[model samples]
Target: MALCDIGLIGLGTMGSALSLNIAEKGFDIAVWNRRTKVTHAFKAEAGELADKIIATETYEELIAALKSPRAIILMVPAGGPVDDQIAQLRPLLDPEDMIIDAGNANFHNTRTRAASGEPFIGIGVSGGEDGARHGPSIMGGGPKESWDSVAHILEAISAKYEGQPCATWMGPDGAGHFVKAVHNGIEYADMQMIAEVYGIMRDGMGMDAAAIGGVFEAWNKGPLQSYLIEISGEVAKAIDPKTGGAMLDAIVDAAGQKGTGRWTAIEAQHLAAPVPAIEAAVAARNLSSRRDARALGEELFGAAPKHLPHETLSIDTLEQALIAGKILCYAQGFVMLSAASEEFQWSLPLPAIAEVWREGCIIRSAMLNDMSEALTEDPERNLMFAPYFSDHLKKNHGALRQVVAQAALHGLAAPALLSGLSYFDTMRTARGTANMIQGQRDFFGRHSFVHIDGSEGQHGPWAD
Candidate 1:
């Protein structure tokens, strides 16, 4: 049997989508899942191309079907299950056999896993359900030779967003997962920012879901246009089917996280980098999950502070705030990614990464295209100094500040958006209060000052 170039071990949403991509590309695909029914489900769902995908009943059969020196892609859940699957495969496969873990496994775990006897690559995939079905942003970190062997297939399957391939090599040994972890950390912040927009629009500005959705649709046509905003519009318009209502009962208020976002925050803490927006987003999700605490707080503290009843907010104004908040959220995310790249020595191409996210990924945006262009032209260019971003922040920081103040006045939590904006403001403002301490240190510790003598290095007294 010709060695099967593609084998997928999971048939979940991501795995299935990837399998389709592979099969569509004319690669012979052998798919197996731990749960037998998932394979059956895949068979049922996969029309016409079903015969090309062989469902395996046993691990040995699956391995045998792939032939020698097999290249298998594991799209299973991260952590222990991945370990277990690898253990089973190691004994059955040869040294040249390759495995790619495409799930969002922890980078530390991925590094440790790669250190095992068998050769494997940790790949991080983004662009959630839709990205899976169509294409997704793929990041891989492993042996250069291993990456080379699979690069062609990876590119074929990955989603092309913003005129760049969604798949890229993020250097060796866990870098891909690390970058993806940061991607997800940014994703959390982005989601929270959208939620804040909704809250402010509904509770503060009194815009209906359709109106909010309409604003988002228009925002999609501009520089702030993005996949997230487009989806937000659809979600805003989604109504409860049963009750003929605007509320979606299918989605619970309690959001359960898969721990990657928390891991990103934890990693940031370890790196001695501030990820306030991401951290705040994670905290907000946790707070949402803690229903008992919320109820208790309400009971113990009595009625919450009141804001003006929902009033109609202009679509134009809402769109502007959305744009500003989106920029801030991305800015913070990129900063965190930059910090991580520096700390981990990944040497990631920021602009290239941004380009991939512009099309197929959930966070795909016109802003990312600009980001991609800026960073591609100069890899070392920090986003804070990017001309477009700087100009946008300069023009809209005032509006963001006002929105944040108004949200706070109404007791709405907008930590991600607000923190990101604050970060941007701090980065840009030359004489802002944020750097007062640094200036004070220059005056006291370094004895460097804007001197009255009008010379290069003149002194200024701190106690004066």
Candidate 2:
């Protein structure tokens, strides 16, 4: 008897990789793709394994192959296409059938999709194709009862990082994708910061890519070690056959991003959360990818700032600089999430979220150990106020400043990471320019402002 537990729609890179992971875990899979040829090809590739994988070109056939009130995941591009597919599937699917939107769909859309009176899960699957094939970070948001129904299959497909499956039912409504979206936003900023480090090392310090990679590898052994740093070291060492040197030189400087990263920044802005790094990350990608940015700048301002060489940085100095930037990256990601959780009423658990990412997510860092310890002691403690982290940030602010200064000296952009660090520092301080900004808000909008003086200031008039 063909025993299929999960039905996968769309076998593109993500879908195909995830299918492999699920099937390898001893679960039957029913597969379908809009392009029948692709489905046929996947069927051919499955061979004897194909027996377990029932392939169908039609949604009805795919639904027919599933177990009663079946569980299905849609890996299609989110937006109108997802809605169209869901509309088609709704009639065929029973009321109790479960549908997981496993793509990078906006949580807003996830919320809307979930309102259909059926169990709809908005899942944020991070780690890309490799993560799907191996283990990736998974964030699910929906009814708890629905998660109870389908979580076993989710756990099987998720990669274990730090002894826990990198999968969590984040919260209600759109919380899962919201977390995932923000995770990608953080990822964008994190990648840019690492790339800037590479630029500084290669261009400013007169080091080769391999040399930079070597330093990154060394750093990975210490408190700064992370998946990003680990990958950075390998990327730096990757040489071009033609140049017999770093392939980074041959690769285009432009970075492409799906809308999730940009969407995160926009949502941050909407919620009045200061997600400078994520915003900077998105803007940096846009700037880097635009060949005409300089032309546009020249058109507007007549001349763009010329790129300058950075102050010479010793290996030790560069490492210190990296330490600061890396710390700032994690700090910003968490801060944004914390602020968002508050805005959305998700009441997300930070330490658990950090723990899940320890092995699987791209931003997993050695600093997570500190964060995890902090969270474990006080799971509800807002991390910004955590004493140990506060001390670490206070002690390290100088290094972060130095990194930002050095990047600026080279006329390079390090906005997101640097801004995030700045925000973290501003928030941690009991008194700072940020307080002044808050005070002004109260003066203007009649919003109450808390003073360090333990007195509430009356609103409604500035002259008073």
Candidate 3:
């Protein structure tokens, strides 16, 4: 048997799609799965592509099939499974051999695993099943030399935006997954803001799903155009076959999460990064999960008072508000990324990151292209302070403020949107109320407050 260029373990949907994609790129692949049946099934499914894929029933066989300085990609579950696979493979591999974890493992864990004297790359692979089969955005982080060894294969299989592959070596030790977590965090905020807008249309304006779907469809063609927005329109328009009603109405209200967004929020808190929009989105998902509590609250308080009448709300205003909120959410995510880069000494390529996100990922949007350009122009400043986005917020902030106020008055839960508006408002404020917080902290906890004139820390004597 001819030696394969790379070996892949795990035959899950993502794993299979990625393997097929790699093979289609003309690289011979050796594949193994925990279950022999799965490996065989995948080989059968490969059809004509099977010639390029070597299915191995054992780890030793898989290892033997790969060439010297072997590259093996693991598509197992995050956490224990990833560690388990690495442990199993380490004993059979040489120092120069590489192990790439392509799942959504936490970045800290990636760092720990890499520090174990193993040549490992924790890569972030985004875009869903279809994207895995065709092309997906890839962000890799490990030793620069290790990354270079497999860079050609990764770049070849990644999605392209105007001939530039949506793949890049982010930074050493877990930067890729860290960026991926922030990506998901921004995704949470994006989806939540879209849902909030749909809520306003459905409840505040008394519009049906079809009408709201049309609104989202229109938004998809404008500044708000994105995969999430486009999907929201499709989801809203879906009809239930059994009930002949809107599919969204038939679906459950509860939202499910896989922890990346939560991780992003926790990391933001640890880094002292203000990511209220992402936090609010994660909180909203948690709130949604407590359906029983919500029901009880509704019974206790009676129905929420509806203040924003259907005739009073404007669809145009809602669109503008969503655009502003999205901008704020992206700003928060990018700011968090900047903080993480500084804290970790990663020197993350923010412009390249934005460029990678412009094509294949869930967050892909025209705005990302603009973001790439903005960051390229001023790599040091926060995204909110970028000239293009600052002007964007300046133009659309009124709509955001109005929408937030309307949601509050009407008893709607638009937490993400509200947080976005607040984040934007706070960022632009030269004199915030932090001094009061500092004073209270100093009085209660002896955490001294610094003066504005670069003076020494001072404490007040409070009279009881």
| TM-scores of all candidate predictions against the true structure | 0.88, 0.89, 0.97
> Which candidate leads the pack in TM-score?
3
- What's the C-alpha lDDT at position 322 in model 2? 59
Q: Model 2: per-residue lDDT, tens digit, 64-103?
A: 8899878999999989879988889988888889888999
Q: Locate the minimum summed-lDDT window of 10 residues in model 2.
A: 303-312
lDDT of each: 0.77, 0.78, 0.91
Regarding TM-score, does 1 or 3 come out ahead? Answer: 3
* Higher-ranked by lDDT: 1 or 2: 2
Candidate 1 per-residue C-alpha lDDT over 93-145 given as tens digits, one digit per residue, 9 for 90 to 100: 87789889989899999888877746789888888877776778888898878
Ranking by lDDT: 3, 2, 1
Clash pairs of candidate 1?
136-159, 161-359, 205-311
Clashes of each: 3, 2, 0
User: Quick one: ranking by TM-score, best first?
Assistant: 3, 2, 1
How many clashes show up in model 2? Answer: 2
Clashes of 3: 0
Model 1 misplaced regions, further than 4 Å: 1-3, 162-164, 249-251, 299-315, 429-464
TM-score of 2: 0.89
Worst lDDT run of 10 residues, candidate 1, spans 304-313
- Cα miss at 77, model 1 (Å)? 1.5
